[model samples]
Target: MAVDLNEFKHPSWITAAGAITGYLLILIVLTVALFIVPWLVFLAL
Candidate 1:
């Protein structure tokens, strides 16, 4: 089977958007977890 690179092409903006959204999601989750764990530990004491 052969694949065509042209047929699998994505626009630059789409790639950039995907990367930016993924980065933001990871950042938000990390930020939430970072703060929440400390608070939970404090409460458990």
Candidate 2:
């Protein structure tokens, strides 16, 4: 699916909030992965 970037140009605050939310979500996933990966590796051994 293709999205038009022009459609997203109207509201600046919404865009900024979305960007921040996406960034924080990614940060949280990575942080959880850091803890989970080691446990998985240890289980495999």
Best by lDDT: 2
Q: Tens-digit lDDT track for model 2 on 8-43?
A: 677886889899999999999997799788889889
Could you say which candidate leads in TM-score? 1
Candidate 2 wrongly placed segments (more than 4 Å): 1-10, 36-45
Ten-residue region with minimum lDDT total, candidate 2 = 5-14
lDDT of 1 at 35: 93
Candidate 1: tens digits of C-alpha lDDT, residues 12-41: 767888899999999999987999888998
lDDT of 2 at 14: 81
RMSD from true fold, candidate 2? 6.0
TM-scores for all predictions = 0.60, 0.56
